[model samples]
Target: MTCKKNMVIIRSFKQRPVCSECQMRSLSGPVSDKKFKKLFDIDPKFYETSAFLRDIRYQYSLYQNLTEKQIAAFKRVVDEFKNPKKKQINAIVPKAPTKEEQAEHKQKRAKGLFQSERSTLRALRTK
Candidate 1:
């Protein structure tokens, strides 16, 4: 649905009742609210994955003029996905190395193919 400030072009399908989703529409982008329902009903966890993340990210960008309430609702859905209680598998990815480990890593990086990989200007002439 296209909108400009106060005016909006609301959609009407032949079968379903009138949409109460104008507010929802503004944030969720051009994908009809019906699609959201169908996807959620099929699997509530679908939104937690990359497909839904990509959809919402695109929607957020496409519909930049959403109200604060709609934005909150959008964030709530994302937060629900990120809730720790729902975590089952190895969601806790590996941790970053300590500073000493990082220093060691940098030292390793400075020693190996790093020198040979340098630009021609940075490389020394043959002895």
Candidate 2:
């Protein structure tokens, strides 16, 4: 019988590796003309400028705050036009709701339903 010393090596085959540039691209919402210039050191063509601006605004609004790591990443992109080789920025992965959190959410939803029911009952009683 042959024994495997590194289970990770076997498991690695099952998972696909994603590059940092891809990860950054995924996290980035959109680049504005100004931001695009800052990051890429090039402006969008005259026709595409407005659309590019809108996209950047949308992305900024969508992500309320940029983390330090994200900011550093932005800077890093500006420093080097080439794709980042290192995965310095940690991807934000939302955690699954815990049992307690799920229960709390359910309780809040139930309370909202109860409030609506009570309001309806009061309205019917008044009429």
Candidate 3:
């Protein structure tokens, strides 16, 4: 990540990451609403810049006040809640089954062990 100001040089092996102290001191004092707006008032030279980076920086500033352990716990909780394995959000509308799959599904449905969607399934044999 490149800083807007040439404050630090990041290297692969030897350089330390930007310290939290430096981050807090970059634009000092408790962030008031006016100060927050001032930090975000970028040079109007660029037309309609996205506020994504500014939003992230604001979040970072707010998070900086938390203790190191608190930050760790916050990260842990976010990770826990964002588990990829637990992702199960699905569309309410089901997809149409393929011809081969429809045959298997029909068999299962006949045996009363599976459910077929209300939509008619394509058949492998016409007659």
User: lDDT of all predictions, in order shown?
Assistant: 0.49, 0.48, 0.46
lDDT (0-100) at residue 72 of candidate 1?
66
Give RMSD to native, each candidate.
13.9, 18.7, 15.1
> Could you tell me every candidate's TM-score relative to the true structure?
0.24, 0.22, 0.22
Index of the highest-lDDT prediction: 1
Candidate 3: count the clashes: 0
Q: Model 3, range 1-127, lDDT digits (tens) per residue?
A: 3245546545566544543334434534455566445533443221123222333344556664434564465444434544635444555557778999989978888976633333223233343
lDDT of 1 at 12: 52
> Lowest summed-lDDT stretch of 10 residues in model 2?
1-10
Clashing pairs for predicted structure model 3, backbone only: none
Residue 5 in candidate 1 has what lDDT? 43
